[model samples]
Target: MRNTQQRKTEWLNIQWKGGVMTHPVQQDGSSCGVIVVLMAREIMKAFPNVPILQFGTSRKEMANERKMMALQILKASVFDEAENCSMCSLKKPTGSVHRFINWIQCDTCERWYHEKCLGMAKEDLEQARANTWSCILCS
Candidate 1:
């Protein structure tokens, strides 16, 4: 199997035109997938006429676009519940120590919690891993 960096590089190689477009540099290691999806959405909105496989624009231009898109996201007033832990209601800041904690989401209630908060042992949690998991209350 490809290693993490190799897999990431392979993902970045997806073409937009003849030129390969670079993925935005994520501010942190966490939430990269979310950032990528958001970046793609912003790019699509900004360049509706541009073909997905065409990267006629410069990298610098795309970087600037990304910055602008980030600003737009920050300016929006809508809040996402996933920004906090469901049980404790603690904000999960990207750079905080909580970022390193193992958090699980309940598929039924769509709520998030630190694994320890749910009285889950690390081994038990690993053994029970599934595509969708429900918390004890939901289960």
Candidate 2:
């Protein structure tokens, strides 16, 4: 047979070199994306050495993966890191706070940080040598 464009495009089933491996069937409707991402992570971590032991994910595990994936999305996010606290560096800090009061700013660089994010506790505020306290980078 002559080499042809049709044959090249048609090579999927007829020309497959290695045996195919099947991913486990999705159990939950919403977990499809999570399962795909989980599979990729598992492959990257274990390929060429260890074999994957399981792929049947439970609904509870999917829920956990959803949170984990959200966190990963935030941490691996493309948004401006400059807006985040230099210490924790998360795009947004959690919980209720009065920004002007609960958040503190460095006297030097002027970067803002959540009170909980600081290494110093509220009690340690009195122990500070001077009224002005610098952020970790500034100090």
Best by lDDT: 2
Cα RMSD for candidates in order: 18.6, 14.3
Between which residue pairs do clashes occur in model 1? 16-53, 16-54, 16-55, 17-53, 17-54
Estimate, for each residue in 22-129, the C-alpha lDDT of model 1 and write its tens digit. Answer: 545544334455556655776787785753543323455456656776888867834555766766666553345654787787788877876756677777787656
Q: Which stretches of candidate 1 lie over 4 Å from their true place?
A: 1-80, 92-99
Candidate 2 whole-model C-alpha lDDT, 0 to 1: 0.69
Residues 1-139, model 2: lDDT tens digits? 4445755744344654777555456666668798878878888888876658475588888888889889988888765435667666654566545445345667888777766677576677654434887877877
lDDT of each: 0.63, 0.69
Ten-residue region with minimum lDDT total, candidate 2: 94-103
Clashes of each: 5, 0
- Candidate 1 matches the true fold with a TM-score of 0.34
